[model samples]
Target chain A: MIGAAQLLPFSLLGALVGADVVSFPQAMLSRPIVAATLGGALAGNVAAGVLTGAVLEMVAMETLPVGASRYPEWGSASLVGGAIAGWHPVMRPGAINHGVFVGIATAWAGGWSMYALRRLNGVWAERALPAMEAGSRRAVMSLQLRGLTADLFRAAIVTAIALLVWTPINDYALAHWTVGRAAAHSILAAAAAAVAGGAIWRQSHGAAGSKWYLLAGAVLGVVLVIVA
Target chain B: MTASDRAPTTIAPALSWSARIAVFTRMFAVQGSWNYETMLGPGIGFCAEPALRELPGGPDGPAYRDALARETRYFNAHPYLAAVAIGALVRAELEGRPAGQIERFRTAMCGPLGSLGDRLVWAGWLPFCSLVALLAFGLHASPLVIVLLFLGLYNAGHVALRAWGVSTGWRSGLRVAASLGSPLLQRGPQYLARAVLFLAGLALPLAIARVIGRRGLEIPSHDWKIALPLAALFAIVLAALLVRLPARVEGWRAALVVLAVLILISIAR
Candidate 1:
């Protein structure tokens, strides 16, 4: 179990990665694969983090953050998921699945939080409207700085709240898990693959010359599988 | 508000490298204030402020204020490619171009840059790199290696786009459309999409194998022989469902509910 003291740094990382989503550099660090893995490291279980991250990534592929389209915020959500998964670092029944559940839920809520932030920004922009109209450099800088600060705080709050709510549930689920290990692993794997399948379909659906590439890649994949 | 501020745009003296770099760096934060009203308008203003400081009023002057006001006004563009708009707009302001022309340029640049970056980065390159990393995970790569590989590969293209974008926009000014015609912008997404589709095919199988095989985590007494056939069958079925699942189905939500139900049942037992 993570102690109360450890939660601060964990939540802080969550804030940084969360801000990276759309606030700061927009680097891929906010990505599920990276964020989860980082969270795993923080929790002393890199493998656990990667496992959760892999599952999250498959579902996240379906989400494209194109201009203004509402999509789940995966950065902090994945971190929460990764931390939960890495806490015990056991690949046992009910371990990873619960984490993924928590992550998906956080991401869904994070999307709404982002929408709210947009409105809050509207309010701030309204306040700065006069100075902006006067072409004040201070006004522009102030708005950007305030917006950036608010987003960071938003991610931190979302992350802290998710961790508080989900950690005990994850522990309980893992404690009470009764399914055979094989079945549990198989079920989670199947869910992940299914999500990947949907994502792959979306990627290949209407693109020109994608079928050939997919086929060629499949052959290469098969050869690699057989060779290994 | 004056004739010169609204005069027809002409290529003006080159922006000092210092000013150009300042604008470039600030462009990264352009989406910080993204909102419903102006979308990226305020951010655009933020980035343009440094350059506008060079106006006769030196940040407090009428010329600076006029250009800053117009530049910062409502605007939208892809975050990565926004440097392009910033670069061009800075050049136009320095040249004392018409307000309407700068406004039109700002409006015109958004759709193309947004779609172009979306196609190039989001739809194309992002998934391609992710699939590569996924394959590495399947193959049991170390955590650091997998992360470094993904970030290094993804950011190479990401940083390059920004580095090139601002400069390109500055040089081309109103002629920025020509840059879009380049093979990298035009055909780049198509190639990346094809590669991503292929990588997706390659990675998915291996990932399924890892999942069912319980590879890497290497649980003791894991029988591959029994798991392989069952895993293959489950993979096919679930993957089909994922692909064919209707939009109406809230797949993730439903999955959560089902898991919750199962957990409750276990608790009851």
Candidate 2:
């Protein structure tokens, strides 16, 4: 029965992590594994979120947020992981799937929120243009604060809502959702492998003569199986 | 239109260090959504199509200031776009150029910067970090460790790129990309880097698998899976459709196609 109030910490943490991606002292704490683990820890499910975040983080490793390039809204992706892991019932070992769904969905939500926030910042800055031209530092400062504050509030609200609504739903899912272990592992592992292969494909597909990168990744996959 | 105004007397306000940091933060605002062109709504990231407004002042009280207000309007419409536009604005003002001249320079920078930014930063760098994260998944490591590693690789790379972009001009940013060569050759180095890191990423997983061989971590046996191969078939079919389609289709459409294919496969099971 988590409520909107319960989501404040995740929202605040998400904003802080998102902020760190571009501003502040640049602490790496906002990362998926760390942030999600922290989220789980807050909700008394550190182990689940941490485990799921680790997997998702690995799959996400190929994404590099280079200049003006759009990345997966990891701010929310990690938050979802933490939330799911924290709130989902652990008596059943199938909690990871719930976290995955939540993480992926939240990542999408975070991305949209970021765009809205950017638009908001732009409008705020425009309103202060006269004062800005007149050497009014206070005006410019105020506008900047407005943008920052709005973003902080948005993250807090999203976190609160997701936790309050999603937690109980997740419980119902765990209690009812049924799939064989063979099927579950086959699907999850396959999906993860496909994503990994795609990453290798993307990297190798671009090289001039290096078809070997793909071969290497394949060999690595085989090695993983052999060793496992 | 006055000679004095063109004589470099209209000094733009100096941005403080804190302001610069805020501007830097603005980069993240556009990081995962759209490229500069889309965000700016078709022209140069923001400078190309500034929103105009009527000032309350008299006819000749610095009409350029009104234009400045328009520029400000452009910034206020989209902060991230504003940051890109302002970078050029600051450069133009520093050079004592008129609005027309500034617009020209911004126009010149936007196309290449947008294309390169899309490829280098979003397309190339972000995916590489995701691969690193994926390796952690393979290891079944704790989520905390994964997030920390992801934060380390991604934020470090992103912030460093932004710092580089802000400190140096767009030219330097391009030069950095060029240093890696065309997109085709650029990833060769990354693959090599990945191979090295793959070894590192695989270490713990290998050790644990050895200890738990044929136990705890075993996958239950099943019939040869039909789902993934079907997905691959669907992807190939769609990719062929995409390739055969006219190139005039929008870039977002292409992204959507790929996304659709991925989603179909991910959910097919």
Candidate 3:
């Protein structure tokens, strides 16, 4: 029931943006920051939700989700992640560790779901190829609607599962595992850093000249932290 | 084949003014679950073919080619709004003009609009989203803030690109690029390069995520300052992977390499 409640908003957002990915007005609703915030708002933790979303946004920044290139479905992933993060007891009063973990796991699942749905979209597109080639605007619109609606259903299911399962799984794991709080937190931090590093490195690879930009961004980031 | 060989039904009636504009806008507006191949090529085909049939020659070989050329030129100028002016143009041609004038007009429009789409839509508007998203992150704003900022920025870009791309695709075609201060030839490759980089930027994050999963490493901070540098590092590694691949692998395969390395690192760790 909790999952269903959270999932509804994400499903709607995904349908809206996923449809927008190809249909209606092109909008940025699928973006992680926006999606996560919406998820957080629905979950009643706007701040935590946005925090988790921002992290996912940073981690997933390089994704364009254009064409056949499979990308993490931030629209749904952010929603699930934001909900989980916002709900975590440890995340209030500016503690972001629990929220971050939830965000990471949810975002990973979201990426997988996105890939799965891409395959589904391909199958549906093939089925609709005749109508697609028929030169009927309405026919093309129907095909687009079909794939988009399917995506909505897929995201909804994923969100519902994630939200329903997160707390139980988190408790079981936490109860079973005993590590220093710092160590456990460090591991999460390290993972986030590694992901961030990997993401940055990947982009820098594309533009060798962008090293300076990367360096500049890092220095600026550090400066902001020191000042804050 | 000569015009005489054409069937009588092939020469359909002209599209109305409103219809022309609709055709133009529909070009870019078609998207969501469909991939770029589907939307840009086949999707356009769906609208263009009918719009062509509604025209005098029913988008005859020359007409179809002309439409494609016009769309392509418009795409180049206003890559973001390539679809906006197409419907309107097709509608206008279908509605009928003096014989021999359509081709001339289409040809004229192709060059400028192509350039305009590239500059105004592709370069100008796309970067706007990045700026807003980046600023929000820098400020440590809430997810809602980033999302809202992105929405505002993207919509602004969208509206501007639509208005400008359509106007140029309609009025000057190829000259639209010139009006936007983008020389067609020189800017074309640069634009292509930029697109490649932007795509690379987008792909970098996912690639990084995969790598970290493989490496079993995590970041220590929830801040963008740390995140940005990490992203930069990931990009470089990706570039190196691209360089190291035996053959020139395109797209996702390259991402796979990054994933492979990440897994190796994870195992090693």
Best by lDDT: 1
Per-residue lDDT of candidate 2, residues A1-228 (tens digit): 765566666777777766544333334465565667777777777766665565455445444444344455665567666667567445243455566556656665766776666666556555555575553434534554565567666666666666666787777765665554333333433333334334444433555444454445545644774554
Rounded to one decimal, what is candidate 3's iRMSD? 8.6
Question: By DockQ, is 1 or 2 better?
Answer: 1
Error of 1 at A100 (Å): 1.3
lDDT of 1 by residue, B58-130 (tens): 7667888888888777777789988888878887887777787888888888888888888888888888888
- For model 1 chain B, the run of ten residues with the poorest summed lDDT: B2-11
Interface RMSD of each: 2.3, 8.4, 8.6
TM-scores of all predicted structures: 0.93, 0.64, 0.62
Ranking by lDDT: 1, 3, 2
Instruction: Report RMSD (Å) for each prediction in the order shown.
Output: 2.4, 8.3, 8.6
Which regions in candidate 1 have their CA more than 4 angstroms from the true location?
Answer: A1-3, B1-12, B218-235, B242-269
lDDT of each: 0.79, 0.48, 0.49
The DockQ of predicted model 3 stands at 0.16
Task: Mark the 10 consecutive residues where model 3 chain B has the least summed lDDT.
Answer: B70-79
State the DockQ, from 0 to 1, for candidate 1.
0.62
Q: Residue B142 of candidate 2: its Cα lDDT?
A: 56
